[model samples]
Target: MYHYTDFDRQFIHQRAAQYRDQLERNLRGELKDDEFRPLRLQNGWYVQRYAPMLRVAVPYGELSSRQLRVLSKIARDYDQPSAAVYAHASATQAELGTPHLPVGHGHFSTRQNVQFNWIPLDKSADVMDLLAKVDLHGIQTSGNCIRNITSDALAGIAPDEDIDPRPYAEIMRQWSTLHPEFAHLPRKFKIAITGAEEDRAATAWHDVGLHLRRNALGQIGFKVLVGGGMGRTPVIASTLREFLPWDQILNYLEAVVRVYNRFGRRDNLYKARIKILVKAEGQRFVDEVEAEFAQIVAHDGGQHTIPQAELARVSKHFLPPALVQPAQAATTNIAFEFTDKEAADYQRWLHQNVHAHKNPALRAVTLSFKRLGFAPGDATADQLCAAADLADRFSAGEVRVTHEQNLLLPWVQATDLPALWLAARSLGVAKANIGLLTDMITCPGGDFCALANARSIPLAAGIAERYQDLDELFDIGPVDLHISGCMNSCGHHHTGHIGVLGVDKDGREWYQVSLGGSDGSSLSGEAVPGKVIGPSFAASEVTDVVEALLDTYRAQRLAGEPFIASVRRLGLAPFKQAANAVRHETRDGGQVLHVHLSTVDAATD
Candidate 1:
């Protein structure tokens, strides 16, 4: 874990003191709500449904054991002992759990980013004091600020990475932390860096997604994507700079943020993301902004220069784990032991859950959260603590939160599988259905989020319940059933193999189903939904519809065909027909059409 420098310490101390004064004034009613809103927001405080929520930036989801302990302590001391901890990019509260005290502290993988929900307004200063002592601060966690600079969690360790991205991420973090030049942006901005060949950083879904790559000259550089984001209007980022030199990253990013800060919309909150700005201004305008910033950087060589000394300094902090000599191959490992009974199971999990590591003997294991009945991406406090323990015991005392809302033990020894699996099973984190139909990425709809049109958690729960048999689920193969409450696409419904987006039709909730969406480097984004089905079905009906669609696809598909590939090949007509046929056949008949009477009766009830 990177420690804060004196400069970092000074900056946070000053910010905390400033916020403390502001908070005191607000309590004294000297500052009105309107006046205090931005101040609190700048400090990562949001006035949510129940109480003020504080988001503590974790900076790329890499947490040391000590940091995890601090978070656990924060939850136990300040909130309820059972306060939930969720992985980043998981669904909101409505999709996860009931409203409660010590509200959940979600791991916003942005795990790199840390946020705290339900921080008592009066106790916020105390919370800050506690965080400050531990070298953690919420300086640029929120507001119209360059929020936490996110990077690929597997940046350095992934086998196919071009270079370690943590050092650059750290550089960006330092440069952007309370940056004076563009703090007052028209909207919040986000930046992501990924050195991995895989787009683990959700590069297409950020304001700036930097893919570290090498040019023809063989010098390490970045492939920069800009203005990509998700909100009301979702757009995949477009390439802004191809192969920007390593030294120019900060200057270029500053230029980009500065342009958005000056030109992004502030009057309309809904249209305030950088994507909207880019869309309105056109790519050419964005190019001009970059050009302007580049000129500035060129003029002030002192500010933008990447000093060799600084690079060396930052690199030392993010140095890869010392390489160890190859250990003897364990032919009698867990995989061999479970070859007959669990081999097939383990193979499926290995294919989807395990990631290639920089070291051949080591592998990164993904703990899938998509279980039979639990909401996707959810873990109770006990589960979280257990995960922390697992990381400590088995994975070199570090843990990572994936963008898919799952935990990753990035450095698990290949030989420790059996014990780790048993321990994980004890904690309810041992589901082996990573990337299978059961491994869904869903959002919390209507339940806790004010933005949802319908409840998505129940929908996911219903689906999981329908396919409770693991054998049946595994047979279905790689199926992604992503459901989102609204068009905001937080659940990434647009990228599911079978995407379901909840919509409110009049007063009744309905679902729109799309096919062939995927979130990966080669093929990202899905086609628009071909069929809008149901004015909301009963839980059983929803499952039946999904089953019918799956059956239809299975019946018509070729061997070795994935759901998305089959859908793409066969088109959505068969699936749509199957879904509608089931819905129509299942619809209750001979029901009286007394709309006025029903309305009155419903109101009375």
Candidate 2:
């Protein structure tokens, strides 16, 4: 993990002081809501459905044990103490003339983001001061700027990855942070980097996705994807440049951002993303702009190539920890006996959570969030503290955050698996579903987010509850059920095997179902929904629909067919028919509408 330097410390402290004064002015009524909105956004504070929400940037999703402890402390002291209790109950009670809802403010771990809800804006500067003292800051968490650059969280530890992408991601972070050229872009931009062969980072749906690989000549290079984004107009990025050498990466990226900033629409906030620009102007125009910018930068003596001294400086910060001899051999613990049921549960967790590291004796263990009857990506203060303790004891004080919104201990010894799992279970972090269907990637939807049209976390929990039988889910094979509350696609619905997108139709929340979309090296573009299922059922009914869809896929699939493959082969008709049948039969007096199959046979036809 990268530690903050003295310069970083001073910069954050100064920024905090400035924000304190702004807060005072706003409280004094000198600044109206409209006037204070930009300032609050820049400081990562938003007036959400509750009190206030503060999104903290976990750059590249890496956190030290100390940082995790700081977050835990913040959750306990400043935010809501309980996992699901509301912070501004008094205010809500006063406004509504009734009792407040019992809901807790918890931490939400996104693919490459962490958000803390129910913050007090007036006291936020004090919180910022505490964070700065711990060498943590929230500088670019929001605003119309380049957001936190995300990379594969299992970068160096994943067995199938080509290289560690954190170093490059950090380099990009420093260059893009407060860059004057892009600070005034039409809308927020996101960048993702992936080193793994499997697309865990959802790179295909980012504004810029950098797939890192070594060339045949033994030189580092990147496959650049541009114009990939999710919103009202979802478009899977096209390969803009294949095999861009290491030295030319930054210059090329600069060209891309510059083109979007210059030509991307600003008249309509809804259509301001780079995807809209790519669609309206076509790839040829985007290519021309890139070429023009590249030529100009090249004429200036290639100023954007990472300087040798800077590269060396940043590389030293990311050096792997000193290698340690394993305390015990991998096979020595194979036949070890355990009497306690918790111990046996720990053993089962080890089988699912642990992964092989580059070092033969060491393993990378995942902490899954897919426990039955809990919302994915949520952690309480005590759980966070417990995770920090486990990291310190078993993983050399380092913790990783995954793109699936799970935590990772990247350097656990194979012999320590049982002990680590025991500690994890105590903290509610031990779940035996890493890549399984229940280990879904989700977002905070209508429950908290003001922009969300429907509730996503509840929907995810409902789906997990329906598939509570681990044996049944395992037999079904790998299937991603991603739900996004809105078109922003925060949950990455476009890439799931069974994608559910929430929408608002005539002021009522409904879901649109899509199938056969994938996030991988060989990308599948967004699949349009076969039907718009009206919102009329209780929470349990939603899960029933998912169950029907899964059963339909199982019945229709051929041997060795994955969920995505089956959906692609049979189209969305069969799944739609099955889901409607289940809805009608399971719930009496419920109507099942026949969804039209417009392009069902297009793949074969």
Candidate 3:
């Protein structure tokens, strides 16, 4: 709910105008493909298989209703017609209903941005124009720069928050937007901040994750972790600073990035991320960053100083909206009643999607975009508008995008949850599966992404469909199932309780399953990375293999134990045995090959 200042608006408009001019020049042949490539990528445009993909930034996953409406309008006006080859990430076009827009629907990403898959090059400028009108842009969304800063969706109003981290996140966003010193690094960098005791933002998976903490004297500061990432090599970040004073966070961050910029590998793109540098250098890397921090502070008093007034100014923008008194709201809603089915469903929804808020009268509700047989992170234009309208009615015209690819009305009054749930259900965005296995985090796989080695959408869909039953899902309990199309780890597969990675095997798609990954802080003091099980399986056999893993968990798990905890307790022996035991026969009678399902284009719901 941060409002754009005059300076902010001017900066965005200037960038949009510059990009427009640059795009026109490139289209007119004044610039070659090589010349235009970096320019386009910096603005979040990618030339994929069929057309350009434009990823628009939604800072820290916060958006106003007006902004959401503008996004919906962009989909309606500039999107191309849906294609058979690339429809929903989960199901075929025919099965999910052919989307009129080229991108089918706005594909929400794990980074809290929505990607348009089939954006035409010429019209990308128009898309930029549309985005500018609503205080949104694609600045720093791509290229080797600090991408959009992400924080907990429940930042300002989470019950356990020690301090609101959004202001700090915004402060970093402002400072890093176009910092010349670190503009072109060895590779892209990412940062996440979590204000709550719970790690909703998956801080450990980011290049730098900051957990806001309060000292004994009640002064807020940060616990910094660095070098964590997922790709060909996934590694958990290590402690950079046990506690950094809040006011000096910016300077500390600058020092860390500087160290990475100076030593991060430039020889190979595969080894370019800060994670690799940290791994290669070990404790030496941390020592260098600390030394840099000291030098920065020693010279010129302080390179970066965030005054209290500035913090107040940013915090004001994130102040929670006024809400009705909890007692009054409870009394008013107490008179209401529900039918048997409605009561049961509401209970399930309340248990799953609804979460506690800092204000007693208010509750944060997660609107599940992961419906049965649909892509994990997709929202049609109509659905977007509907969400905007709902937010307007219930959440002070503000909505939030979760890193998990769902919409959240963070300031909904507890009394209004039933009505909001009904409205969300009507729009097909209300599913009670938050934190459940069905609530998978996935990326646009081989079906839409040219970089992918194998199709991931269909496989994710198959897994979701196989466990579509709510009774089964609830019984299975909380599990994070993350799938990636390729090693880019766009889906953060390495952080899931159950991780699925797509790979190329002699021109065919194969999936490698990993067990016991988690984004949340470990109950065991040490950070754990997901370990890959046995060999990869064919695309057709993925769901069955996952089922086998799940069955193993169910059979061996102790009462009330979560999936990840069970995996940690039992190790991979049981899962490996269960998965190896399940077998599927191929159509070529003599030659046995396992084929569980077809591609997304040919598959049904």
User: TM-score of model 2 relative to the true fold?
Assistant: 0.89
State the lDDT of candidate 2 residue by residue for 420-489, as single tens digits: 7667777777867777789887877656666666667767866787777767866787787778876767
Clash totals, every prediction: 16, 5, 2
CA RMSD of all predictions: 6.2, 6.3, 4.5
Query: How accurate locally is residue 374 in candidate 2, as Cα lDDT from 0 to 100?
Result: 53
Clashing pairs in 2: 84-103, 84-104, 85-103, 85-104, 86-103
Per-model TM-score, in order, reads 0.85, 0.89, 0.92
lDDT of 3 by residue, 55-108 (tens): 899889999999999888877666673454344433442332322223546888
Q: Give the TM-score of candidate 1.
A: 0.85
> For model 1, what is the alpha-carbon lDDT of residue 173?
80
lDDT of 2: 0.72
Q: If ranked by TM-score, best first, what sequence of candidates would result?
A: 3, 2, 1
- Candidate 2: stretches off by over 4 Å: 81-105, 323-333, 339-348, 521-540, 586-605
**Which candidate, 1 or 2, would have the higher lDDT against the true structure?**
2
Candidates by lDDT, descending order: 3, 2, 1
Name the lDDT value of residue 228 in candidate 2: 78
